[model samples]
Target: MKTLKLILIFCLLFLFTLSFAQTKGSFKVIVHKSNSNSSLNKVEISKLFLKKTTRWKGSKQKVEPVDLVDTSPVRENFSTEIHNKKVGAIKAYWQKLIFSGRRVPPPEKKTDIDVLKYVHENTGAIGYVSNSANLKNYDVKILKVE
Candidate 1:
């Protein structure tokens, strides 16, 4: 009985640690160096991801948005923290929007590097990635959330 109790406690501790890591993982909203704005609030960033704010108006051009894969943990955290909704809900919103031909979702990449590359190469693009990603060599800049 004692061994069984100890095993149960260990399992619970493991689960708790996983949940803590999920909640603690850091994220960063990023844009190319050419973007004039250095930071944006959650609401504005949320709008961009939701297709409510489709373009970043430049002196003579528009910028697009890039996104991480739907299943990524970092994406999930971003959706929860910035969009105030779960990933599933966001996906549903996009589905409805697409069905109605009212909107199109941003381009999605499978890895943080892909997202950074997209934002780096496109002057008008913005994206997000894990905070610990190797961004030193890229022309990407982090956008502070106000």
Candidate 2:
């Protein structure tokens, strides 16, 4: 019985570790270099992505949030970390709004390059990309998330 208990505990620990690893994602929030705000809290970032805040403070530029394709791991991590929800839940939120003609979800890019390109070109755009994405050639800066 003691041996069986130990085996069960070991399996539980392994499952816990695996689950934790899956929830953590490597990503960085980025914006056009011209944006004055250097950092934002998670709530502020969430508001921007959710369209609750449509305009940049002290500016007339509209906030354009971009997302990675639904299947992308970066997108999954982003939804989990920033919105505290799964990607499907976020999609559902957008779907309800769209059904009512209220709003639409942010545009989704297929890859990190596309996202970087979009955010670099749009002054008010905000996006997240994989931590491995090279931003050196892009006219964008990473926004420190607090």
Candidate 3:
């Protein structure tokens, strides 16, 4: 009986550890060095993500926003935490915009490393990644969400 109880305890502990491991951390929106000091509010950031605003003010260069697709956990977190919308709702919103020919979805990268590299090189780019990512070599600044 004691041996059986010990095995049961081990199984429960293993399940608990697995559950904890599944939880992920939040990511922060960041901008390329050229857009670091833009003073963008949450509304503006939302607009950029929604493709409502396209151009940078000082220059004619178009501002590019990058995002992960519907399946990404980071995308899900950003939709829920930052945008206050479910993933499905966000997809519908983008679908409407695309159907109207007003905007196209931002280019997507498969990983945070790809996002970091793309944003770092592009002057008018913005993207998000896990806050714990190593960003020392990149000249990017995290945007403060209002």
Top candidate, metric lDDT: 2
Q: Give the Cα RMSD of candidate 2.
A: 4.9
lDDT per residue, candidate 1, 1-146, as tens digits?
99999999999999999977975656899988878887788998998778686677554446588878888899988999999999899989999999999988888999999998899899888888987798988998999999
lDDT of 3 by residue, 1-146 (tens): 99999999999999998866544747778888777355667777877777778887677577888987667788888778767898899789878878998877888787788888888999888888876677779978887777
What clash count does candidate 3 reach? 0
lDDT of each: 0.86, 0.93, 0.80
Sorted by lDDT (best first), the order is 2, 1, 3
The estimated TM-scores of all candidates read 0.80, 0.83, 0.75
lDDT minimum window of 10 residues, candidate 2: 18-27
Please give the range of 10 consecutive residues that has the lowest summed lDDT in model 3. Answer: 19-28
- Estimate, for each residue in 8-102, the C-alpha lDDT of model 2 and write its tens digit: 99999999999767645679999999998999999999999999999998776899999999999889889889999999999999999999999
Candidate 1, position 36, lDDT: 83
In model 3, residue pairs whose N, Cα or C atoms come closer than 3 Å (at least 3 residues apart or on different chains), thus clashing, are none
Report lDDT (Cα) of residue 99, candidate 3. Answer: 94
Superposed model 1: Cα runs more than 4 Å off: 1-24, 57-60
